[model samples]
Target: MTGSPEAQTSQTAEKLPLPIRLIDGLSGLSAALAAAGLVLLALNVFLDVLGRTFLHRAIPGTIDMTINWWMPMLALLAFGYTEKMQDHIKVTVLLDSLPIGLRRAIEGVFSLLAAVLLMFLAYYTWVDAARSAKIGETTSSSPPVMIWPFKFVAVAGVIVLSLQLLATAWRNFSGRLPREIDFDVDEAAL
Candidate 1:
Protein backbone atom coordinates (compact mmCIF):
# COMPACT_ATOMS: atom_id res chain seq x y z
CA MET A 1 0.00 0.00 0.00
CA THR A 2 0.98 3.63 -0.15
CA GLY A 3 2.23 5.79 2.64
CA SER A 4 -0.05 8.27 4.43
CA PRO A 5 -1.52 11.24 2.58
CA GLU A 6 0.96 13.55 4.25
CA ALA A 7 3.94 11.60 2.91
CA GLN A 8 2.43 11.43 -0.56
CA THR A 9 1.80 15.17 -0.56
CA SER A 10 5.36 15.93 0.49
CA GLN A 11 6.86 13.73 -2.23
CA THR A 12 5.21 15.85 -4.95
CA ALA A 13 5.23 19.05 -2.94
CA GLU A 14 7.02 21.14 -5.52
CA LYS A 15 4.57 20.18 -8.25
CA LEU A 16 1.50 21.30 -6.33
CA PRO A 17 -0.81 23.84 -8.00
CA LEU A 18 -0.28 27.53 -7.33
CA PRO A 19 -2.99 27.87 -4.69
CA ILE A 20 -1.68 24.84 -2.80
CA ARG A 21 1.87 26.19 -3.08
CA LEU A 22 0.83 29.54 -1.68
CA ILE A 23 -1.03 27.81 1.15
CA ASP A 24 2.01 25.64 1.88
CA GLY A 25 4.33 28.64 2.05
CA LEU A 26 2.00 30.54 4.30
CA SER A 27 1.54 27.42 6.43
CA GLY A 28 5.30 27.12 6.86
CA LEU A 29 5.49 30.69 8.12
CA SER A 30 2.52 30.15 10.43
CA ALA A 31 4.05 26.95 11.79
CA ALA A 32 7.18 28.87 12.80
CA LEU A 33 5.08 31.52 14.49
CA ALA A 34 3.11 28.82 16.32
CA ALA A 35 6.34 27.19 17.50
CA ALA A 36 7.60 30.49 18.90
CA GLY A 37 4.23 31.03 20.54
CA LEU A 38 4.50 27.62 22.18
CA VAL A 39 7.94 28.44 23.56
CA LEU A 40 6.78 31.77 24.90
CA LEU A 41 3.67 30.21 26.39
CA ALA A 42 5.74 27.62 28.19
CA LEU A 43 8.12 30.24 29.57
CA ASN A 44 5.29 32.42 30.69
CA VAL A 45 3.54 29.58 32.51
CA PHE A 46 6.79 28.39 34.08
CA LEU A 47 7.66 31.83 35.37
CA ASP A 48 4.19 32.33 36.70
CA VAL A 49 4.29 29.03 38.55
CA LEU A 50 7.73 29.74 40.01
CA GLY A 51 6.73 33.19 41.17
CA ARG A 52 3.49 31.95 42.73
CA THR A 53 5.02 28.95 44.45
CA PHE A 54 8.29 30.33 45.90
CA LEU A 55 8.01 34.10 45.75
CA HIS A 56 4.51 34.15 47.24
CA ARG A 57 3.28 36.24 44.32
CA ALA A 58 1.85 35.56 40.90
CA ILE A 59 3.30 37.08 37.76
CA PRO A 60 1.35 40.19 37.05
CA GLY A 61 -0.91 39.95 34.01
CA THR A 62 0.19 36.41 33.17
CA ILE A 63 -3.33 35.13 32.61
CA ASP A 64 -4.33 38.27 30.82
CA MET A 65 -1.33 38.05 28.54
CA THR A 66 -1.93 34.42 27.72
CA ILE A 67 -5.64 34.73 27.10
CA ASN A 68 -5.44 38.01 25.24
CA TRP A 69 -2.27 37.57 23.20
CA TRP A 70 -0.50 34.19 23.27
CA MET A 71 -3.62 32.03 23.25
CA PRO A 72 -4.98 33.42 20.00
CA MET A 73 -1.56 33.20 18.37
CA LEU A 74 -1.10 29.62 19.44
CA ALA A 75 -4.62 28.53 18.58
CA LEU A 76 -5.06 30.04 15.12
CA LEU A 77 -1.51 30.11 13.72
CA ALA A 78 -1.45 26.45 12.63
CA PHE A 79 -4.64 26.38 10.58
CA GLY A 80 -3.01 26.33 7.15
CA TYR A 81 -0.24 23.97 8.20
CA THR A 82 -2.70 21.40 9.49
CA GLU A 83 -4.80 21.70 6.33
CA LYS A 84 -1.75 21.37 4.05
CA MET A 85 -0.58 18.35 6.00
CA GLN A 86 -3.97 16.65 5.68
CA ASP A 87 -3.63 15.71 9.30
CA HIS A 88 -7.04 16.87 10.32
CA ILE A 89 -9.58 14.33 11.52
CA LYS A 90 -11.69 12.74 8.79
CA VAL A 91 -14.08 9.82 8.57
CA THR A 92 -12.78 7.71 5.71
CA VAL A 93 -14.29 4.31 6.44
CA LEU A 94 -17.23 4.74 4.07
CA LEU A 95 -15.17 6.54 1.49
CA ASP A 96 -12.55 3.84 1.49
CA SER A 97 -15.16 1.15 0.99
CA LEU A 98 -16.71 2.91 -1.99
CA PRO A 99 -15.52 2.40 -5.55
CA ILE A 100 -12.75 4.75 -6.71
CA GLY A 101 -14.81 6.91 -9.03
CA LEU A 102 -17.69 7.24 -6.60
CA ARG A 103 -15.36 8.00 -3.71
CA ARG A 104 -13.65 10.71 -5.72
CA ALA A 105 -16.96 12.25 -6.70
CA ILE A 106 -18.10 12.37 -3.09
CA GLU A 107 -14.80 13.84 -1.93
CA GLY A 108 -14.93 16.51 -4.60
CA VAL A 109 -18.41 17.56 -3.61
CA PHE A 110 -17.49 17.71 0.07
CA SER A 111 -14.33 19.62 -0.68
CA LEU A 112 -16.28 22.26 -2.55
CA LEU A 113 -18.73 22.55 0.31
CA ALA A 114 -15.94 22.98 2.82
CA ALA A 115 -14.29 25.60 0.64
CA VAL A 116 -17.49 27.61 0.40
CA LEU A 117 -18.05 27.50 4.17
CA LEU A 118 -14.46 28.47 4.87
CA MET A 119 -14.68 31.36 2.45
CA PHE A 120 -17.65 32.74 4.34
CA LEU A 121 -15.82 32.25 7.61
CA ALA A 122 -12.75 34.08 6.34
CA TYR A 123 -14.79 36.95 5.04
CA TYR A 124 -16.74 37.38 8.26
CA THR A 125 -13.59 37.11 10.36
CA TRP A 126 -11.82 39.76 8.30
CA VAL A 127 -14.81 42.07 8.63
CA ASP A 128 -14.80 41.61 12.39
CA ALA A 129 -11.08 42.29 12.50
CA ALA A 130 -11.63 45.52 10.61
CA ARG A 131 -14.36 46.55 12.99
CA SER A 132 -12.19 45.77 15.99
CA ALA A 133 -9.39 47.84 14.56
CA LYS A 134 -11.71 50.73 13.90
CA ILE A 135 -13.01 50.72 17.44
CA GLY A 136 -9.62 49.88 19.06
CA GLU A 137 -11.07 46.94 20.97
CA THR A 138 -9.21 45.93 24.13
CA THR A 139 -9.38 43.13 26.65
CA SER A 140 -10.66 43.89 30.13
CA SER A 141 -7.30 43.57 31.80
CA SER A 142 -5.54 45.99 34.18
CA PRO A 143 -3.69 47.59 31.29
CA PRO A 144 -6.20 46.41 28.73
CA VAL A 145 -4.40 44.81 25.82
CA MET A 146 -5.39 45.82 22.30
CA ILE A 147 -7.12 42.85 20.66
CA TRP A 148 -7.27 43.91 17.02
CA PRO A 149 -3.88 42.43 16.15
CA PHE A 150 -4.90 39.04 17.45
CA LYS A 151 -8.16 39.30 15.55
CA PHE A 152 -6.24 40.13 12.40
CA VAL A 153 -4.02 37.12 12.98
CA ALA A 154 -7.14 35.00 13.24
CA VAL A 155 -8.40 36.47 9.97
CA ALA A 156 -5.11 35.66 8.29
CA GLY A 157 -5.22 32.07 9.53
CA VAL A 158 -8.82 31.58 8.37
CA ILE A 159 -7.99 33.05 4.97
CA VAL A 160 -5.12 30.64 4.57
CA LEU A 161 -7.34 27.69 5.48
CA SER A 162 -9.99 28.88 3.02
CA LEU A 163 -7.43 29.10 0.24
CA GLN A 164 -6.14 25.63 1.06
CA LEU A 165 -9.67 24.24 0.98
CA LEU A 166 -10.27 25.83 -2.39
CA ALA A 167 -7.06 24.28 -3.64
CA THR A 168 -8.13 20.86 -2.40
CA ALA A 169 -11.47 21.25 -4.18
CA TRP A 170 -9.72 22.19 -7.39
CA ARG A 171 -7.37 19.26 -7.07
CA ASN A 172 -10.32 16.92 -6.71
CA PHE A 173 -12.12 18.44 -9.68
CA SER A 174 -8.98 18.17 -11.84
CA GLY A 175 -8.28 14.57 -10.78
CA ARG A 176 -4.87 15.47 -9.38
CA LEU A 177 -5.49 14.21 -5.84
CA PRO A 178 -5.73 10.87 -4.09
CA ARG A 179 -2.28 9.97 -5.37
CA GLU A 180 -1.60 6.74 -3.54
CA ILE A 181 1.98 6.33 -4.71
CA ASP A 182 4.34 4.13 -2.75
CA PHE A 183 7.76 5.78 -2.79
CA ASP A 184 9.33 3.43 -0.29
CA VAL A 185 10.05 -0.33 -0.14
CA ASP A 186 11.56 -0.84 -3.57
CA GLU A 187 10.49 -4.00 -5.40
CA ALA A 188 14.08 -4.44 -6.53
CA ALA A 189 15.08 -4.94 -2.94
CA LEU A 190 12.83 -7.96 -2.82
Candidate 2:
Protein backbone atom coordinates (compact mmCIF):
# COMPACT_ATOMS: atom_id res chain seq x y z
CA MET A 1 0.00 0.00 0.00
CA THR A 2 1.13 3.55 -0.74
CA GLY A 3 1.96 5.94 2.08
CA SER A 4 0.16 9.20 2.94
CA PRO A 5 -0.07 12.22 0.64
CA GLU A 6 2.77 13.93 2.50
CA ALA A 7 4.93 10.87 1.97
CA GLN A 8 4.08 10.90 -1.69
CA THR A 9 4.81 14.62 -1.83
CA SER A 10 8.20 13.91 -0.29
CA GLN A 11 8.94 11.27 -2.86
CA THR A 12 8.48 13.48 -5.88
CA ALA A 13 10.34 16.77 -5.70
CA GLU A 14 9.97 18.60 -9.00
CA LYS A 15 13.28 19.62 -10.44
CA LEU A 16 13.67 22.88 -12.34
CA PRO A 17 16.41 23.60 -14.82
CA LEU A 18 18.29 26.66 -16.11
CA PRO A 19 18.22 28.88 -13.02
CA ILE A 20 19.50 26.10 -10.83
CA ARG A 21 22.29 25.33 -13.24
CA LEU A 22 23.25 28.98 -13.51
CA ILE A 23 23.33 29.46 -9.76
CA ASP A 24 25.32 26.25 -9.36
CA GLY A 25 27.85 27.47 -11.92
CA LEU A 26 28.13 30.80 -10.18
CA SER A 27 28.61 29.04 -6.88
CA GLY A 28 31.49 27.03 -8.36
CA LEU A 29 33.08 30.26 -9.55
CA SER A 30 32.67 31.76 -6.10
CA ALA A 31 34.32 28.70 -4.56
CA ALA A 32 37.24 29.11 -6.95
CA LEU A 33 37.59 32.76 -5.99
CA ALA A 34 37.49 31.83 -2.31
CA ALA A 35 40.21 29.21 -2.85
CA ALA A 36 42.37 31.75 -4.63
CA GLY A 37 41.82 34.29 -1.85
CA LEU A 38 42.80 31.73 0.78
CA VAL A 39 45.95 30.90 -1.15
CA LEU A 40 46.89 34.57 -1.38
CA LEU A 41 46.21 35.05 2.32
CA ALA A 42 48.33 32.03 3.17
CA LEU A 43 51.18 33.31 1.03
CA ASN A 44 50.97 36.69 2.69
CA VAL A 45 51.07 35.08 6.13
CA PHE A 46 54.04 32.92 5.18
CA LEU A 47 55.97 35.89 3.88
CA ASP A 48 55.18 37.96 6.96
CA VAL A 49 56.27 35.19 9.31
CA LEU A 50 59.43 34.48 7.38
CA GLY A 51 60.42 38.15 7.25
CA ARG A 52 59.67 38.81 10.92
CA THR A 53 61.22 35.64 12.35
CA PHE A 54 64.32 35.07 10.21
CA LEU A 55 65.03 38.40 8.54
CA HIS A 56 63.96 40.39 11.63
CA ARG A 57 62.17 42.85 9.33
CA ALA A 58 58.50 42.69 8.48
CA ILE A 59 57.28 43.42 5.00
CA PRO A 60 56.07 46.99 4.84
CA GLY A 61 52.27 47.26 4.79
CA THR A 62 51.79 43.48 4.98
CA ILE A 63 49.42 43.82 7.89
CA ASP A 64 47.52 46.68 6.30
CA MET A 65 47.41 44.97 2.92
CA THR A 66 45.91 41.79 4.34
CA ILE A 67 43.58 43.25 6.94
CA ASN A 68 42.22 46.29 5.13
CA TRP A 69 42.31 44.97 1.58
CA TRP A 70 42.53 41.20 1.11
CA MET A 71 40.32 40.31 4.05
CA PRO A 72 37.40 42.40 2.89
CA MET A 73 37.85 41.23 -0.67
CA LEU A 74 37.88 37.61 0.44
CA ALA A 75 34.78 38.07 2.56
CA LEU A 76 32.84 39.87 -0.17
CA LEU A 77 33.90 37.44 -2.86
CA ALA A 78 32.80 34.47 -0.75
CA PHE A 79 29.39 35.78 0.31
CA GLY A 80 27.43 34.75 -2.76
CA TYR A 81 29.37 31.53 -3.04
CA THR A 82 28.60 30.57 0.50
CA GLU A 83 24.96 31.44 0.11
CA LYS A 84 24.75 29.45 -3.10
CA MET A 85 26.17 26.45 -1.28
CA GLN A 86 23.59 26.99 1.50
CA ASP A 87 26.30 27.46 4.06
CA HIS A 88 24.70 30.43 5.78
CA ILE A 89 23.31 30.09 9.28
CA LYS A 90 19.65 30.09 10.10
CA VAL A 91 17.29 29.83 13.07
CA THR A 92 16.06 26.35 12.34
CA VAL A 93 14.33 25.62 15.64
CA LEU A 94 11.00 26.91 14.49
CA LEU A 95 11.46 25.82 10.92
CA ASP A 96 12.25 22.26 11.85
CA SER A 97 9.14 21.88 13.99
CA LEU A 98 6.79 23.30 11.42
CA PRO A 99 4.85 21.52 8.68
CA ILE A 100 6.29 21.49 5.19
CA GLY A 101 3.86 24.08 3.83
CA LEU A 102 4.39 26.44 6.75
CA ARG A 103 8.13 25.99 6.48
CA ARG A 104 8.02 26.85 2.81
CA ALA A 105 6.04 29.99 3.51
CA ILE A 106 8.53 31.12 6.11
CA GLU A 107 11.39 30.34 3.77
CA GLY A 108 9.74 32.37 1.04
CA VAL A 109 9.49 35.39 3.31
CA PHE A 110 13.08 35.00 4.46
CA SER A 111 14.36 34.62 0.90
CA LEU A 112 12.52 37.79 -0.13
CA LEU A 113 14.02 39.72 2.75
CA ALA A 114 17.51 38.46 1.89
CA ALA A 115 17.04 39.38 -1.77
CA VAL A 116 16.03 42.94 -0.89
CA LEU A 117 18.82 43.39 1.61
CA LEU A 118 21.46 42.04 -0.76
CA MET A 119 20.20 44.25 -3.61
CA PHE A 120 20.46 47.32 -1.38
CA LEU A 121 23.94 46.31 -0.30
CA ALA A 122 24.98 45.91 -3.92
CA TYR A 123 23.67 49.35 -4.85
CA TYR A 124 25.34 51.18 -1.96
CA THR A 125 28.61 49.28 -2.30
CA TRP A 126 28.75 50.19 -5.97
CA VAL A 127 28.27 53.83 -5.07
CA ASP A 128 30.95 53.61 -2.40
CA ALA A 129 33.34 51.89 -4.82
CA ALA A 130 32.79 54.57 -7.43
CA ARG A 131 33.44 57.32 -4.89
CA SER A 132 36.56 55.60 -3.61
CA ALA A 133 37.84 55.17 -7.15
CA LYS A 134 37.18 58.82 -7.94
CA ILE A 135 38.91 60.03 -4.78
CA GLY A 136 41.83 57.65 -5.39
CA GLU A 137 41.62 56.03 -1.99
CA THR A 138 44.73 54.06 -1.05
CA THR A 139 46.28 52.46 2.00
CA SER A 140 48.24 54.83 4.16
CA SER A 141 51.12 52.37 4.59
CA SER A 142 54.06 51.84 2.27
CA PRO A 143 53.41 50.00 -1.02
CA PRO A 144 49.91 51.37 -1.09
CA VAL A 145 47.20 49.33 -2.71
CA MET A 146 44.02 50.97 -3.96
CA ILE A 147 40.94 50.44 -1.74
CA TRP A 148 38.43 50.60 -4.55
CA PRO A 149 39.08 47.02 -5.65
CA PHE A 150 37.91 45.69 -2.31
CA LYS A 151 34.86 47.90 -2.54
CA PHE A 152 34.15 46.48 -5.98
CA VAL A 153 34.29 42.97 -4.53
CA ALA A 154 31.68 44.00 -1.98
CA VAL A 155 29.40 45.25 -4.74
CA ALA A 156 29.90 42.20 -6.93
CA GLY A 157 29.25 39.70 -4.15
CA VAL A 158 26.05 41.40 -3.09
CA ILE A 159 24.76 41.53 -6.66
CA VAL A 160 25.48 37.85 -7.17
CA LEU A 161 23.91 36.94 -3.84
CA SER A 162 20.83 38.97 -4.73
CA LEU A 163 20.46 37.08 -8.00
CA GLN A 164 20.79 33.76 -6.17
CA LEU A 165 18.20 34.77 -3.59
CA LEU A 166 15.77 35.74 -6.34
CA ALA A 167 16.20 32.38 -7.99
CA THR A 168 15.69 30.62 -4.67
CA ALA A 169 12.53 32.58 -3.97
CA TRP A 170 11.13 31.86 -7.41
CA ARG A 171 11.83 28.16 -7.03
CA ASN A 172 10.25 28.09 -3.60
CA PHE A 173 7.13 29.95 -4.69
CA SER A 174 6.69 27.61 -7.60
CA GLY A 175 7.02 24.63 -5.25
CA ARG A 176 9.93 23.41 -7.27
CA LEU A 177 12.26 23.66 -4.31
CA PRO A 178 11.83 21.46 -1.27
CA ARG A 179 11.20 22.97 2.14
CA GLU A 180 14.61 21.74 3.21
CA ILE A 181 16.48 22.57 0.05
CA ASP A 182 18.94 24.65 2.00
CA PHE A 183 19.34 21.97 4.64
CA ASP A 184 20.41 19.04 2.54
CA VAL A 185 22.90 17.27 4.76
CA ASP A 186 25.00 15.83 1.93
CA GLU A 187 26.02 19.25 0.65
CA ALA A 188 26.00 20.87 4.06
CA ALA A 189 28.33 18.26 5.50
CA LEU A 190 31.00 19.28 3.03
TM-score of each: 0.79, 0.78
Candidate 1 CA-lDDT value: 0.76
lDDT of 2 by residue, 1-190 (tens): 2887677544543344667667756756876786787888889989999999999988787777788667876887777666654667776866766776777777878888989998887898899999998999998767886777778877777777887777667666666653336442345555
| Residue range 89-180, candidate 1, lDDT tens digits | 87775776566666667877887788789889889999999999999998877767778888888887777777767666666666665354
Q: How well does candidate 1 match the true structure in TM-score terms?
A: 0.79
lDDT of each: 0.76, 0.73
Location of the lowest summed lDDT over 10 successive residues in candidate 1: 177-186
lDDT of 2 at 181: 66
Candidate 2 whole-model C-alpha lDDT, 0 to 1: 0.73
Which model scores highest in lDDT?
1
Q: What is the Å distance of residue 160 in model 2 from its true position?
A: 1.5
